[model samples]
Target: MSDPAARLGLGLAAIARPAYITSGRSGDLGDERGVGTLRARTRELLDAGYAAGIRYLDVARSYGRAEEFLAGWLADHPEVDDVEIGSKWGYRYVGGWRMDAATHEIKDHSLQAFTEQYALTHELIGDRLAVYHVHSATVDTGVLDDARVHRAMAHLRDEGIRVGISTSGPAQGDAVRRALEVRVDGEPLFTSFQSTWNPLEPSAGPALAEAADAGARVIVKEVFANGRLAPGGGDGTDGARAAADLAERAGVPLDRLAVAAALARPWARRVLLGPVSVAQLASNVAGAELVLPSGVDDELAALAEPPERYWATRSARSWS
Candidate 1:
């Protein structure tokens, strides 16, 4: 198998914004959420991740100026040349940098959303943007069936940028399968997929495997389940308690165990780690190096919750 570190990507979701839905953010990020503070922090994470051999950097337009922060880092660090950048559109950040905002992001998967966001991303990230994904694509959204959107994505592909989709919710598998059938001029439109697939939400595993078999890049996000699987994190749910016990029995940290399980998946070409601090980043790197013991897989497999229940719980989480 290839070295796990080579397959680990640093995701800017947690660190790019002040308030997020991930657990333990109050402790991880503290009260300093000014634009300058986050910009500096993003630079620190980018530097640390690059030094640790993480080449792929994941971001999104809805991640509160994440593309802008990444662009600034790239400009300052011209010597680092081997980074692969992947970003998502379809969601617009509406938090206004305030934690009390009723809405943090607004999702729009229309051609208008793609056109506007793509222009912004390209303006900031330029040629460094290698893969552009339709953020949070779902079956009900009809983004996969939109011919106008397909043509726009195909144009991007023609310019050498791979078009892809990042799925969310309980229907991620369905969305992934639908994306597979999306063809422009008889050629496959999507060549990469990003989806949440922690031990608690392995519902997308089968469809992701099918995508890999079709020669598409598969990136696993939220492997820590938005901090539910991390150490000292999680609500008092049965799955959370079971995961804690299993991690203890495996003699590894909860987050590391979660990461190892995600990495162990044969279809997971790249597993994204969203760490708020350098210490967390180091721990995540250790997770990539971990080798889980036998039978632990079965224990982890048993921790999965019903997709609807799991997503319902996720939807209720408060952004801090």
Candidate 2:
């Protein structure tokens, strides 16, 4: 066996198993049970991921019918319990968006709503949940410090759930910093921080590193730059070459290189990926075992240098 945490160098290469196999109204992957092709094809991906030792499972309430799909899948297949399942709350899905809005963008973080949403998990997801989040990705400077949300989260933690926040969007790093600064009776606010991190988007690096120094665990999302930075894929040609060359040199696939790069970063405590199929999952875990060619990062960083959209300037300057 490997160190799991250490071999990832940065952390383990976790198969993200995206809640959304396809985009949904909530900005998360809507469920795919209706997708006839997916229904028949993904059992291999799940089996392969578990065989490859991926131990973390991530999904959210607003991610289409993800929880329902997971429940159905796991119920039919009881062999997939070795991994930890983490889900998020604090948001709702309606009107083609997944933001928190009780009535026209107010953003519900009330202890009442939070608890209601939390309980919904057991109903839709059964009792396999291993971690929970405050849905930090939906929060901003406007509501990061709310008492109702924080209090309910604290209550959940005291009850023995591994509570954390899911931060996405521009000011994600700042959100991580703020989440880190929060404390209860002098104790830290969160145990883990999930953010968008990849070679193309290092926006979370500063905060992630700071959190690492502060002894907080880090779980990285967007390890593949939302699937653009992976092998044989991308909207532009920017870092593709560097990624390909490095992938070859490392004797690993491009997507694996992307994931391995994340896992290898000191501040990165976990690498979460979204594998649409089982082969992809197997390929990802195998790639994690590859050691990058010397200085491949320099090439990657160079190719990844050109400024672009969210994928390039990963920094979240939008929170204000």
Candidate 3:
């Protein structure tokens, strides 16, 4: 039972890059070249994470060779039991490793697949994994009531492993929320859900609220709006402006204010900011140390209302 509050800056402490989880297919990310150096890189990143107070790490089979690299680091590493790992299943890969060329895709959420996948990854990342999130359809598709998906995930939880789904967007969030409301197995079958919550596409609001009200864990990805929230090209300019006004009133920076606004959501457990550098990671973690004053926080909240339109017609979202 790791401290949830500590896990607050807790989960997915911004990953240091050229470890882009968003890109693949062209780059030899998991090839011999990448694998040779990845473990050391991960160790460096983990050291930085510890310094920054991040206790949870999220990885998946498809995230290049991330898990295998981590597996190497945590094997006899002193930090083995210090952090939490939340990995996923569903997308089958070639070889046991994610780097190999695709033999085929299982694409099935069967209980057998889930259990087997979990065992495969679990065998690699045991004490490191504190949670298991089914990685649902993420490539321009949505998750439905796939019974196999449900049963396999439930199987994981029944074994005492915390199970959940890291949904893609509003569509999946809607499904997950519905499942929770109905209490599939006398209670919400899943303990957590990962989705979007950014100024660009704030569509996660309704479902997020529902899950929160139900006391389900709401882990957010793309909180920085895929780095658009940073002050550049005025990408999140409108959101940033609204955030700035909120920050001014609250006496905080836009980034800190933005993440704090997310924390304001009673159900949001953590915001994942997968940064590409140590500097970027620091900015995100610094957000948690900030406690906005009431007057300022209130002002920031109001500013979010008027300019919601600016971010609407935008595309080319970044989930990294």
User: Evaluated with lDDT, which candidate comes out highest?
Assistant: 1
lDDT of 2 by residue, 248-298 (tens): 776777887887787778787678767665555667676677676788777
lDDT of 1 by residue, 1-320 (tens): 36568899999988888899899999988898999999999999999999988999999999997999999999999998898999999999999999899999999999999999999999999999899999999989989899999999999999899989999899999999999999998999999999999999999999999999999999999999998999989789999989998999888999999889999999899999999899999998899988889899998999999999999999999999
Considering summed lDDT, which 10 consecutive residues are worst modelled in model 1?
A: 1-10
By TM-score rank, best first, the candidates go: 1, 2, 3
Candidate with better lDDT, 1 vs 3? 1
Candidate 2 least-lDDT 10 residues = 9-18
Where model 3 places Cα greater than 4 Å from the true spot, the runs are 1-39, 91-116, 136-144, 181-187, 233-253, 293-320
lDDT of each: 0.93, 0.62, 0.58
Tell me the tens digit of each residue's lDDT in model 3 across 1-320. 24323535332222322223232212323333344555565566666666776776777765555677677767757654667678877666443333333332346555666677788788888755768877764424333355666666666677777777776543555656655643346656777777666554556667777876877777777665544455331344555556545545655556665666666666677766564345556666777766666565455444442223533423342322
Off by over 4 Å in 1: none
- Superposed on all Cα atoms, the candidates' RMSDs to the truth, in angstroms, are 0.8, 6.1, 5.8
Query: Against the true structure, what is each candidate's TM-score?
Result: 0.99, 0.77, 0.72
